[model samples]
Target chain A: MSEDPGSPKPIVTFLGPVASYTHQATLDAFSSSDFTLTPVVTIDDVFASVQSGTSHRGVVPFENSSNGSVVFTLDLFADLQHKYPDIIVCGESYIAVQHCLLGHPDSHHASHPISVSERTGGSRVGSGVIESPLSSGAVTPTSAIPNPQKPTARPVGDLARIKKLYSHPQAWGQCKIFLNAYLKGVERQDVSSTSRAAQLVAEDLTGESAAVSSVIAAKIHGLEVLARGIEDRGDNTTRFFVIRKRAEAEVGDATSVDRKEIGKDEQGEGDWKTLVSFTIDHANPGSLAHSLAVFEKYGLNLTSINTRPSGVENWNYIFFVELKGRREEGIEDGPVNKALKSLYGVCRSWRWLGSWENRLAR
Target chain B: MSEDPGSPKPIVTFLGPVASYTHQATLDAFSSSDFTLTPVVTIDDVFASVQSGTSHRGVVPFENSSNGSVVFTLDLFADLQHKYPDIIVCGESYIAVQHCLLGHPDSHHASHPISVSERTGGSRVGSGVIESPLSSGAVTPTSAIPNPQKPTARPVGDLARIKKLYSHPQAWGQCKIFLNAYLKGVERQDVSSTSRAAQLVAEDLTGESAAVSSVIAAKIHGLEVLARGIEDRGDNTTRFFVIRKRAEAEVGDATSVDRKEIGKDEQGEGDWKTLVSFTIDHANPGSLAHSLAVFEKYGLNLTSINTRPSGVENWNYIFFVELKGRREEGIEDGPVNKALKSLYGVCRSWRWLGSWENRLAR
Candidate 1:
């Protein structure tokens, strides 16, 4: 990918290996002509890249419907934002994970067998002694037998009987509570990924192991699903952010000639999401409540609030808040921004995380 | 571990080998002596053990400050409550995780040295860099030599220069934005735990690998620290729950006696956290809003709210809420429980996730 050095598009870094989900999302967010995409290997690198000017911005996972908050992501933004004034959140994207269970073909059949038992009764009245024969060839008709030759058919017993459970640690952690109750006496292990767990379960010769992973994993691994729809919440979704350098102000007067050339297509109606990170002057009293009041005064609906101690002394805090509004819609000079500006003494540094409607949502 | 059948203590089943953190928390909540403890393998087993009457309760993780709500746990409750009518929640616990990084000693100094660099010419510029030199024997004036006797520091190159990036997947994910930023083009992998990640990073002979894990991992694995405080969020915490079969009303009364006995030693000022899981008749339009109003009317502080769609078709939605009050506190049942009970038509089931206060406040 080669381009002019003096282009408007900023470099946005994300974790990737080309086809990784993060990479796919990056492609969805920016067109090849509009942005320069760089795949980084760590969230810290995302921060450093932006701070060191190697990349204009970086994107990372913050939260999922199944998981609460990507604590590490939250921590980084909360801690480093004040020191590095240039970094800020621009926007977020929501992704739905379609999950399924997979295993080796006919894994269930190999582990569990269905046997029809024939019992002869009338030996002792109503409490008659009846003999049920096992599915093995026996010399005497009355002799009891074990199915030595029959393929082992392990009954998928109650959750209690499950001895082993596998899944990605993150996925497993989310399902921790229910798994504890149902598989009370079972062992839980974290594999590489949910898909890898499914692969392991499918390859298990005894069928005693089961994987709690995505449906995609099951399909890819060719495993028989013992159970399905095993998540705690139905509205399971994960939100991804598209971090970019704060967009430069539009030069309307300077672009008088170009104004006529600007196509109407660029005027598409877009939803707005404003992300602001600020620190309270102190930690004591109602400082947090007071800091939140700035947004409340402007009738802004705060979508999410994440906080982390600034790591300085005395419990100073850095807060990341997502609110609804755009600066271009005269919002930059609006009451909310104005109110934020007024608290310049109390507020540490308030930077916007940009606003954009999700392409998928559109 | 032995007790009279007539004087049975509450039994809570959880996945464990006794040393597990969940097992320790369970003992802390119920007291090792007053309640018989059963170890299960999975969260499902814990619930099944209770449902099958083998154990009275179960404990498992639901959400972590670092992660999120355990999705599978929530899904299991929504489904099982439909199958069994008597199961209920009784308590909750929040645990702090202090992670240490660990690895092998030989490779401890594999990464860049952690020290302030001294630059000549008045030292106007300073940048963090990773470098390894191949020179074993050389000496020259400080100003002229590039320091070849030992590995002279160069900027840490891509993962191709390093063997791999290691850490728990969650940690990796949290630091992903940063990792990718710094190691813009590298390979990332997950180990079973942060300690394991550090261990492998230290063991790698290639000297091109590093792990983004807990401080605990570095200590345990005997690896030199590369970077610390890698999480995105500073206040990373996880919440755990203790669930059990609803004790007979008389049994609850009996447990109070046990509480009093223990209270004598530990300052009896135990706090209560009420957890409730319920479902509204999915067909109703304003059913959920009306149900939530019950808590508002009673002035109950709703701590958390999570929604899950019932896997079974038509009979949809299961809502999990954490509230502040205990049944026996005579905290005034008020209109909420009464309203819940009255909604026999819409309300499905409600249970408490017990609450506890130790050094940490809920």
Candidate 2:
């Protein structure tokens, strides 16, 4: 962490309270630098904070393991970048999330119970209220369910059949496929936080709804979990990011540690990549073809191109892309440069978000 | 709907009971055809039934208004394509869903009950145990909190204050950015289905967890709804597909509908699109890039290219792509086809999905 004595510390904004994962990711990314953290309330705030100068840089959610793309993040960034040219993604990081289910002590008959009965699956469906541990008043479970299955099957007497489910959206999405398969016909909903769901569930005498949240949510919500590790995908993780005003200074072996942990093929000559986003001028025929031709001419390989509705009326778009050699003078640049030159309109722009190799060690 | 007495009718499977929106969509899409309707136990069963030949066609989720892509459907298709060469996509469709919250007659307690309090922002959060005409036994209020500002908030009264949320994983990812902003600090948990979460919460009297699910989840689960229209993004609708071993009969008006929907002018000429999938050997450099170059040389425009990890270790990959123009030779054929031929072994194989226009309006 560099201490820039002369410069004002960079103000970094991210989603959350002190315990929020995004906040932790922000700290992890900028902890060594002369940057100050300003936890914001939401992902939109992260971008807004930076745009408004409330914070030098804003960090927020982008994508997840189970879910393909964080459409909301994409929606916000694409608009912000197109509307506001001043802002750019200087860097990004992928953080994994660890999730846990929470419930109250007596909510479930046993401390740890699994496989709620099929009949009771529909029991937990809505948000419930219970007395709070922190506050003098009782707190409601953000979600709860009534126990309906034969008590003998579950072994736990108080364990409620989880009809309702609570957790962050990402958390829910990752485990959805499995949940759909396992619970079959159960009700699920989204709440403010997992803890609130836990708190509410904790108050329930019947083990109906199970909150697929974090331990923190469980603690705050006062719910004792009936099941754990219920996610469909074993690799139930999410990647988070940290944004800063300026790039961080090189710390002792940090970059190397990152690279090593990610397990990239350092030996392979072409294991690196570059991601660029661009818009084409009024969906012209042969225009994109010609543009892509340039990359071929320059020997630049094209990787992936995803097209989405541009949100602009009468201007639905096609996002053409290419993944190839690094941008250098000696590389074949004829076709690529020509393609760029041939593109039309000031509306077209591109930004590189950096290249990363698939480094997860098997 | 046409039912041919002489010919073997194609079987088209849907998500559920006849009145469901998906079922309606299937009927609308195949109303003119001779087909049999097969109701599956679950969406997965729909896919399985199609693959296993138990049903000629199966309807499954594809995309949504609020959510970007129906990942499970994608995952299923991706997996099937990767595993079985014959499992191909015949046609596609877009459907919309409308949701409502309901409760049992006994749970509807409009009066200020002792167990709960007023809602926040004038909207009651406790939809729990509301005694309504909808059910027999316990009816949960969809909105428990009539006024959130009341200083005397009970732990059981504040179902709306729920920060922790739970739902199907896909729903969470689709609503990621929205949840990150509006409901920050809320713990997110993934369950089998949003419906499951809703069901569990409805049955539980103790409050804590909140589920982000369909309105049906609230009613079926016996829980109260604190709020509605909670998707991170509005226009929250999902597209479902009815896939079968056989394609929809080439009847009437469909082509016109497709052409009208897909027709667009680009580069002062009309252009239609075709979606294709292919697999390329992983070890070879410039293999996939080389294939793309084929399109470039022929002046054929490539719209989108999405790569799915083959799940097979390090040797295979599946690429879902969209390209301009049909397969018949027209523009430049030699170079393009040659490029494809050059990477024969590297290019495991390819399948054409369909070709239409840039946009498919619902």
TM-score, predicted candidate 1 vs. hidden true structure: 0.53
- Segments of candidate 1 deviating more than 4 angstroms: A1-10, A56-59, A62-72, A80-85, A91-239, A247-270, A276-321, A327-352, A358-362, B1-9, B51-53, B61-241, B246-257, B260-362
As a whole number from 0 to 100, the lDDT of residue A161 in candidate 1 is 23
Model 1 over residues B176-245: C-alpha lDDT tens digits?
3344434443445644445456666777765667766554445555565443343445454555666666
Can you give the DockQ of every candidate in the order shown? 0.06, 0.18
DockQ of 2: 0.18
**Per-prediction TM-score of chain B?**
0.62, 0.60
Worst 10 residues of 1 chain A by lDDT: A123-132
Task: Report how far off residue B151 is in candidate 2 (Å).
Answer: 33
> Candidates' lDDT values, in order?
0.50, 0.49
What lDDT score goes with residue A21 in model 2?
Answer: 58
> Top model by lDDT, which number?
1
